[model samples]
Target: MSTPKMFNHKTQLILVALATVLITVFTLHANGYLRHSSEQDALYISEFSLIASVPGAQGLVSTKPADFIARCDGGYLVMDAAEKVSKNLTGVLVDQKNRLISCR
Candidate 1:
């Protein structure tokens, strides 16, 4: 009777390395750390403006609003001249902007 050969040392090492790599990839993908830069679904843009606070504001308030404008990783498109992006709005800022501008 011939005895069956178990996984040799080299085979065992290779299997362990492969498992480690696969597990690492799976974990990164699951946690959203392995996303591609071209994925537009991850892009988010919001409009923020400074509002002057009242003298008698209850919470922490400042009299002078900052003049700095926040810039993100995209080109500028003036809302007035910019065409309608599409009927299918899928993001929070996009939907809110549409609703606010739409005369309903």
Candidate 2:
């Protein structure tokens, strides 16, 4: 039988740090401090949160994951899947609080 190998101090420290980061991420997610990709796709403006607002940009997918936007740089950043789009957005507007106002 082969003897069990022991990890060195540096390896052990690295492993510990990784574990800590994983645990922290899990805790944040469980506590609702982090939002899922679908939740992030939702556009919630104060004035439009209750009303039937305009939909996402045309030619974009209408699925939960395919259509998502993040407010950035004076506009609602179009999100494709979980990424922000940086091109060819026709008319997207955002407020100071980074809420989506309109997209056409």
User: Best by lDDT, which number?
Assistant: 2
> Deviation in angstroms for 26 in model 1?
0.3
**What TM-score should be assigned to candidate 2?**
0.37
Per-residue lDDT of model 1, residues 1-104, tens digit only: 99887989999999999999999999999999996665555554445444567687655557874332223223322232112443332432234345432221
**Could you tell me which residue pairs clash in candidate 2?**
none
Superposed Cα deviation of residue 100, candidate 1 (Å):
30
After superposition, the stretches of candidate 2 with alpha carbons farther than 4 Å from their true spots are 1-5, 39-104
Kindly list the per-residue Cα lDDT of model 2 for residues 6-102, writing each as its tens digit.
9988999999999999999999999999977653346442232233346863443435543334444444444322335434333344566865665
With a 3 Å backbone cut-off (N, CA, C), the pairs that clash in candidate 1 are none
Q: What's the C-alpha lDDT at position 74 in model 1? A: 37
Measured against the true structure, the TM-scores of the candidates, in listed sequence, are 0.35, 0.37
Off by over 4 Å in 1: 39-104
**Per-residue error at 73 for model 1, in Å?**
9.4
Enumerate clash totals for all models, in the order shown. Answer: 0, 0
